[model samples]
Target chain A: METEKGKTFRYLREKREVSQDAKDRLREFNRAKKEILGALKEKDMTVNELGKKLDRPGHEIMFYLMTLVKYGSVEAGDIDDMDEYFSYKLKK
Target chain B: MSDEIRAASYDALVIGGGIAGGEAALDLANNGYKVLLVEKDLSIGGKMILLSKVFPTLDCAACITTPKVSEISRHPGITVFTGAEVTSIEKKGEREFETAVTKRPRYVVEEDCTACQLCEEVCPVVVHDEYQYRLVGRKAAFIPFSIASPRVAAIDIENCTLCGACEKACPPKCIDFTQETEKYIIKTGTVIVATGFKLFDPLKIPRYGYGVYKNVLTSMEMERQLAPTRPFNTILRPGDGKMPDRIAYVLCTGSRDDTIGNPVCSQICCMYSLKQAQLLMGALPMADVTIYYINIRSFGKGFEEFYEQAKGMGISFVKGKVGKITETETGNLILRYEDINENRVMEEEHDMVVLAVGVLPNTDPLSFFRNGELKADQFSFVDQAEVLSSPARTSVKGVFVAGTASGPMDIPDSILSAGAASSEAISYLKQ
Candidate 1:
């Protein structure tokens, strides 16, 4: 829950139609996304390989990978029924 | 040694000891002309010496100007009247002009003022130093700056408040408040009005909140704050006394605005803003600096390189016009600007904001001369004959102007125009 000051800040920010917190978060996310994308572009990698390189848990990496795939942020090869991992590359 | 009025004559009289006047005096004296350079300040080094560095090359401005100060001081044909004011200029003959100049009482004898600062140490009264852009206070009898050329102290009579502590502390007993002002009549072949320029007062803008907000500062104020000898010597917000994590620079505050009646672009403001941003980054390596500019005018040689260097130094160059700057409840600056590329209004908050204020003609020169002798535009000095022509000539044959007295110009242009004015003065004298 937002505090009273945070609520006031939000109300004023909304009246001005400018979101400082949102902008800051978006900037941070964009920076992290760019670093991850650049690493993927450098060489093709499996999910485990990318997770280890990015210093993220396999599940968290899979979440971002799934979101990127949904948004067309990355491309993935077809996964065989018995395949143990998924390979991905950055969308140009 | 006697307290008597002295009458002197010179080939040329330079009314100001700024870049324009200093350069003019040097050139004229070097070319075998007897010159009298009168400066109201206690030293020959003018406003340029107070600056941290010049644009384009980022060369130390003091290093570039101190040599000229020394040259003018050592010139055989040049006599510098520091702490003096030109009262009146009367054209006597076809080519001769008589000027009445008044020298202010220094209180302390120039020869005996060893700059030991003993008088300053014991002086009870402290006054805002106009030379340092009022960023710091000085003793009632104190030198203007650390690099004051003559190394002599000045007596702020207005703020003296009759505190005689400085007089009592003087070891050589040189402090004498009884020193009276003396006037001199100088007959000169020509007069050069190199009164230079004055920075636009940021209070007029109101949006930048310069005078209103403690953290919001003018470019000149920022220069003093960035100086090594600044009172704080750190890039901290004046309001919160905290190092600013993010800084914003608003360009064209008073220049290029038809609303304010200043339509010309202050040519040096853009580059100087970049220079200031670079300097701020150096002082606070972790701070983020954003420069809001309409158009970066990189016309001078190596100017584009300097701009590129600024970008490489991680200074953000946002191509936008700042509309308003407001202080948040947290004492941060909320800058509203239009992102030109995105065509969207962007608002960013910063710890401090600096308004890149423009330069205007020094208005004193207009009041100093007689009515029909010199004509100036609405901004102050006489209008330029043409764009390329030197903007240093007045309507009167023997009178000339230099530096931003004509229009907005950089230091190099001012110095170049000063040299041109000197040649024009020399030619007028010969004719």
Candidate 2:
């Protein structure tokens, strides 16, 4: 059974009609993530290398990389072997 | 020859010279009681003067506060001591307090300083201005700001570097580096603690990436940047100095968060965020502004109207809790939040982000009361012990607290609390 408080979060989205805007904004965000991942592949660089090259905050860069994984632009398995400092490239 | 320096006494001592203190002092003095108003800064106008504009009405904050500052300074019954701090407070008798205050040396005589700013031009050392939220620089010897009441220049001995340029350039020849700090003991029947709250440091929330990302700024920092005389006079990214096409404001950054231990709604964040959005729209007109908030509490008069006006101005309000804020590849902000209405997780990108950080009580007052006569709830406010009474009383008999010292109140609520505190003090005196 759905909990009483948990239902509010579920109903809130439906009532607010955030589907259209959320879908569009998320799509745009994901597109940028894929492009960044593609650029990393072209440069043969890891996430850490891209972070240093782009001068982006590490957590932010990592979050972007995670977005790539969510969008299937970067393989999840590759994230394991990628060095924390030099992990940017996605493996097929 | 009489060697004794005569001492003066007052009915009430008001600490801080901000809106609440000014109002309290005025209210007490108008009631025919002598009031001593002490301010730690060189001028009587407190943080209220630093604001570009106030919320709801969007009135010029300086214009509203400067008049009160002038009135407090000129009132015969109200004596203002700028550049002073309460060193200690002791109970002299039943319902009486003796407060020891220390006055810092201004280096330049107040009457002769003239605010010519000539000393600033010749001063060699430049230091970050604390009054401008450190977004701008000031000379080693300088007036705090353009509208600083009783305009006078002060020397920053810490950053002076002892370069004698200000001393040599002083047309009034008022620079005195060796001016000793003076102490005074004053007795009063009542004390009103109006030391206002401080903005929460956004650095604590690493996910927002405040310090790490130059484009992200706290609400107060945004105010300084929006000021007409601000260094840039434009809302540009600190990292690259580019005007952002889109901006996002994360509401309740520190407040309404059980994890941060500040669960109460900050009371003013919603309205102030709306004000900031309106200001941004006026500046750029085409720039996109979005506010992420869990709930918009427009409980005050004209507050709901202001919120509706922000909506009419095309400012978007997303009912969500921003889970994390990260910077994108293009130096834009990536805000991840769960859309409660959509039943899905979503993220948006914007060029700059502002965190509407909440306020916390000034911790300095606790040092003065030994018996814990003053107490703050979990939210760090000294409100009344019961619901029936005014929310300005302390455990101590004749001492009271007002403004944000009581809780996160807006300008109107702060004024009301100041008036309430004055009445409470008057009643205490009667008893």
Candidate 3:
């Protein structure tokens, strides 16, 4: 339920007109975010492992992982046995 | 939110919200003068708050900044306006100036916000966090930093999708998309310009491979990594998240170079790079740290001693100019330099490279005045015509300049400069 103040504020806001390109980009980002979360739910994995699983580049996977980490949807664990990558796990 | 300041006349208006401006405002307010402080950013603590530690002292930058930020906020004589810009200044009388200021909307009411971060947590958009030097991502609805004064959340309207998730998640329902830019007229007796500098972009030097190389970073980006609120658990190269065993610092990246159109010394790069080297040695005991410089300027209080201390800790200082940096296949960087003492071209390999970029003079003061323009020196900083007698006196009679607004200086010097500016402004008001 929206508070009266919030409802009035929303009514006063100018309707945002999002472009088709921006919508498409948001959809793509949402898709990637969902895929990353689903994959991380199974088990903890390094960025390399997640990239391999998703068939994405390591840097792209790293970006989403870090974003998720910041938002508290994901957590980063200790460095892997190879001492190269930090493992990511979904925060329950 | 300083609501009473809307139609107010003040004794002083201090532009910029960095350490210098904070000090100036505090000084004027303590002297029984009403003040209005304007900061263009969402929060007031400027570049000083973004730093990790100061050179020679190694004091936590936040330790010095947070207290001042709070003091400025609590002072009854000073009213602060964050996320606000002065549009124009017209001189009406000898000491009175009519200034028009525009306050940008944060999209969240400051009084209603609890800073609980629930809105930030629910925000879907992720953008480069400017506070973290873009090394990590921050939500579109975010608090600027952990220790940000006012501790309020602001919406990055540029990146915000207007998804309304934050509105739904907010407990106090503080999210307000209806807020628009508000304008106010302020009449002040005197003005102090303390707007600080912007760092040089390393991308200008193509040979350095700053943007093209994954492991190469600017001094500020490295500073963010060393900060307590750092993105990563440890200081690791961004390329592959690998620990860099060997790190190199290239001094005078954009300053002291004729090609970059900035031919003045930045005045603090040498000591700051030395400070970072010492910090890196403490953080990574096994790592080998090296600094390449054309000349080492350690001519400040305890600065030469700090340099000697860094050297005593086994940090290598190479007297050379790094000509170019080439990246290898495995992500190691090769530095090509002319070793001055050895009289030969030399090459070295390191896992990471940090470019100690310079600072440029901000030319914002020129546009602040509409009647008679505030003048700038040849290098474009606020002109100090009476630097010998009064370093803070500008070309304008009632307008003064503080801190790096005039030229390049270290933190201690900036504080001293602010004190001088405050004293001059007080005298001008008394007249």
Candidate 4:
């Protein structure tokens, strides 16, 4: 049941000498990204809103959101009524 | 492309791929001389390409640089090496300079990459985008910029986790994790050092609250937001993505101050700040813009007129020196300064403050010479032996310095400096 992507990932893991620290950090980061995506799947939210919901800094949330937007995993919509923050949602 | 560079000897070796290096390379190549240009960065267009617009003219920066980048790339006589560093340069004989350079690995094969950006989408790591002044994030696999001359993607191997997502996603299958750094030795008749200046770190001035305050951004950061390919949909402050109602500019953040050790004026800051102010007026018409400066040094051609025009556009030019900045609870900034005109201290609150940070000598180019060190001025800029008559002549006979390598200058002056360096290099090559 090892797919092509999983096989390639395993091969790379064996080839490169990745540190345990780095692996752990990546695991944590992936978890955060999953949380953000899961939240966005439920509803469109501003960076501040996501920050409050996830208990992370607004700036940190913005960085993740923008990265997601860049990769087409997320889409930024119109600014709020107060013309302050742009709402981000899961890509259609 | 690197094959061609490795096989042939060049007539001239131009260090740095900024405006000056590109001009010098083009100038030498146009005169039927073979030239090799090396840039340490991922792309040829240096600080100029990152800018919003040029001062006094207000012409689109990309419009000017894209054609030059294209011309340089397509030029038959010039062989360019991007993502390359000149490891060492030593005189082999009386006429030739032997330079050892290493081309850093771009994990993605340059020739095969179609810039499809699929690899970028699959890469999970999110890192600060230096091109956007860290205002945004970029994937480990990235295209340097929209108008990158080669239009190739490079992997930030340092940040890449060896996840194989990019390799799997790349249609061209150009992603090769096993790729190693390439080394080459180039023999050239003459050398032109045009390695550009680095922006002074505003973080060095602790009182300015650069890193402390989310709203206090460097001038280059603001310039990124003003650029055509801005990070955000609009000009929103980084702290909370709010449209700033009032923005303040603090000029000379790290330059012309004896206390910080750099006492010389960065000639381009005043004009560039004014240019940004004008652009901001167009971008955010309802917003109020104010600039605080010790002096408005507008010495370039039509620079004085440009300053007056900015004033005419209702931009408030306050004659003051901002000493410190502090952030409010709501992410707004309060600038504490001495108002020279009023002869008293003043406090001004604004949604954002941009530190007009100065330029410093890169000095990395000077370290590359193995035989003898190129002489540098007190401030670490490459020194000119005869600045009046021969501004391009470095202490090393066959080696010349141009653009901000010699001293800080505007784009036009940098081009003229490149011309002088190329002309000097040509003369040296003939001898």
Interface Cα RMSD in Å, per prediction: 27.8, 25.2, 3.0, 4.0
Say what the RMSD of model 2 is: 17.8
* Winner by lDDT between candidate 3 and candidate 1: 3
Shares of reference contacts reproduced by the candidates, in order, are 0.00, 0.00, 0.22, 0.28
* Residue-level lDDT tens digits of model 3 in B117-191: 998887777766888877777888899999998799998877777777888888898988777778889999999
TM-score of every candidate relative to the true structure: 0.79, 0.80, 0.94, 0.94
**Candidate 4, residue B168: how far the Cα is off, in Å:** 2.2
Q: How well is each residue in A1-92 modelled by candidate 1, as lDDT tens digits?
A: 21232122232223234245434533544555566687788887765677679876443454345435534567765433433234677777
Q: Per-residue alpha-carbon lDDT of model 1 for B1-431, expressed as tens digits? A: 23676799999999889888899998999999899999988887778888988887778888888887888888899998898998888887867898888998786678887888887776555444576565444656788788877788777765554445666677776665546688898999999988877778888878777867777988887898787666442554555334677888899889999888788788989899989999888887878899998899988988999999999999998999988888786668899889998899999998889888988777777666666557777666555554366456687778887776787788888888888888888888898
DockQ of predicted candidate 1: 0.01
Worst 10 residues of 4 chain B by lDDT: B1-10
Candidate 4 per-residue lDDT over residues B131-248, each given as its tens digit: 9888888877789888887889988866778778888888877876655678788888999999999899988899988877778889999998999898876787777667888999
lDDT of 4 at B125: 73
Interface RMSD of 3: 3.0
* Candidate 2 Cα errors over 4 Å, as ranges: A1-92, B1-8
Q: What is the lDDT of residue B259 in candidate 1?
A: 87
> Given candidate 3, what's the lDDT at residue B347?
99
In terms of docking quality, model 3 is acceptable
